[model samples]
Target: MSDSTAIFDTLKAAIAAEEPVALATVVEGPGTGAKLLLHIDQTAGSLGNPDLDRVVSRDIAGELAAGRTGVRHYGPNGEAREEAVSVFIESFAPPPQMIIFGAVDFTAALVRVAKVLGYRVTVCDARPVFATTQRFPGADVVAVKWPNDLLDEIGHSLGQRDAVCVLTHDNKFDVPAVTGALATGVGYIGVMGSRKTHDNRTVRLREAGVTDEQLAKLMSPIGLDIGARTPEETAVSICAEIIALRTGRDAPTLTAGVGPIHR
Candidate 1:
């Protein structure tokens, strides 16, 4: 097979296994189809020159961390300027996780939406039956374990790209889940509940030693105020809120405003 084909196969396997990898393509240059595949500690395939492969692979890993995919310029010998080559570094970082700490109807809906958003979703609950894979087919992992324990095991993996959604409205589950999630540096922690429920949770969480700064990290009541009553609609609102939070955009109805749909 060709070098590009080999790189494509490697990327496909890494994505299927949920392993982080990146592909660097020579989009503009003498070697247009030339490609390089890189993982954190390993390199498979190459970009013709050994020096070019080493340099491009290192830069591609950085792009993977930020979950970015775009074109970049590089010289034929991988030097700055001169515009001898242009590489398109496509990062397939391990899919960002959406750990839902509940296996309810809302959890199923949220799992579906999370999958649609390309998240490696996990449905965790203390009850084995409720947290079964049958209930959440879309989830990457259906974990029957305590929220805190699960977080303790994999919390370190939760980074800026990941999200923790405490859909277990029950204080017993949500309190610990929220506390554990906050302990990690996860980017988004959304708690599902009504206004009153959230108020009670605030008191409980504070009593449990959640600090003011930590509390600010939470998107309590979970979703945007989209007047969504059904589980599916609520799931959409919640996912939309997560996207809005990441983009720092005001979550307003597009119908109510007029401008370019995207910026």
Candidate 2:
């Protein structure tokens, strides 16, 4: 098949299967009308030159991960900022996943926020009573399983587009949840707790074989420091933090700030 036909077919299949894919089309300057179909595993077409295709693919992957669509400029041979080519990258990404390792009241609020933000959410807790579908109606799934077991089963499916939130706060549940999530490639791992709780958990986590480098990925006291006092407000704060993380934005987080979280 021709490149155009192959790209069209691949794009349709990917979208139908709810797979992440991006299309980069040169709409201006050199190689106008050139196309490149980018998927997580492979590329279908090219943006004229290999360098152009490679550069655009990297940018496309970032846009796809963030579920964004925009036009980008580059030189004829992929040099930065020369504007010799204008490639419009259109991302068709499946909904990002947010697996919350707790079924507390805060988990329900977080499920609502994550659903509103287009995440496919899952609420998991070892307590079968707490992990009911009715309690987290907005969540896509609910599992009454241990955090480590659940993570072991589904962790391989997680990518940089996904997130894992540990809100159990209890040492028995929270520490194991954090370590399990750290093993996944999920872009965000937020743990809910206070300053003292975090300090105490850090000691336990270190003993659990969590290294400083892996511990750095934990967004303890998890959320933007917006004085969120209630569950609903904290839900918003957490969702905002996720967005800021995905877009590489600088925001004041509870993790970085000191003092009381309540105003």
Candidate 3:
């Protein structure tokens, strides 16, 4: 019935459920051995001071989002640049997620690649006939719903470790998909299209109320500039771009250059 017991139970549940969670221990601080269980939905225990808990709580968010673990120092009252407290944070992050909108040939290939890359892949399409588990066996989920509707349902769970790829190629689907993905905190948003298609889709997206700032998050003609000519090759390029973005690495993404996408 104690708070520490409840926090321990919660931590166990999170780990068992494969949810993203972190534990912060006051390893070298005024309240040594104090523990705080942190996850996207829960926070428990404290570090002997309300201010310290509040500051460490905020810092743990960034660590959990990025799946990072290490020690962070703070003043006893959570002041900056002080080593009055040393909280060692340990993060347990779930597999990163990828949601691909479209049930085209590329979708299957992308699903396969994403799975191999340890992503919990979901394939979404408004057309039920095309969006079936039979087609995308590698995907963890095959959602048959409109792009915006699906994103609205699961967008809250998408974080910096997650990605959204719009490969519908149709303006009707691509615009909504890109817009909805922009509304989320997903780290990567890639849309598949030719150079001409990308330009035309941009106009449609703008008309749909997508702002220039939001457009900046999109990687149209989605994928690395690896001269991919096949669906599997394009999938590799797309996944490579996703990894590059998450790691903040410079990559040869197609968006960097203009012209025919094939080139």
Give me the candidate number with maximum TM-score.
Answer: 1
lDDT of 3 by residue, 172-215 (tens): 89988998899899999999999989999999999999988888
Model 2, 58-160: lDDT tens digits are 8888898777999999998898978878999999988789999988989999999999888889899999989999888888899999999999999998888
Q: Estimate every model's Cα lDDT from 0 to 1.
A: 0.85, 0.90, 0.90
Tens digit per residue, CA lDDT, model 1, 119-151: 989999999879898878778899999999999
TM-score of each: 0.90, 0.74, 0.75
Give the residue spans of candidate 1 off by over 4 A: 1-5, 252-263
In model 1, how large is the Cα lDDT of residue 153? 97
**How do the candidates rank by lDDT, highest first?**
3, 2, 1
Candidate with the larger TM-score of 1 and 2:
1
Question: Ten consecutive residues with minimal summed lDDT in candidate 1?
Answer: 254-263
RMSD of each: 5.2, 4.6, 4.2
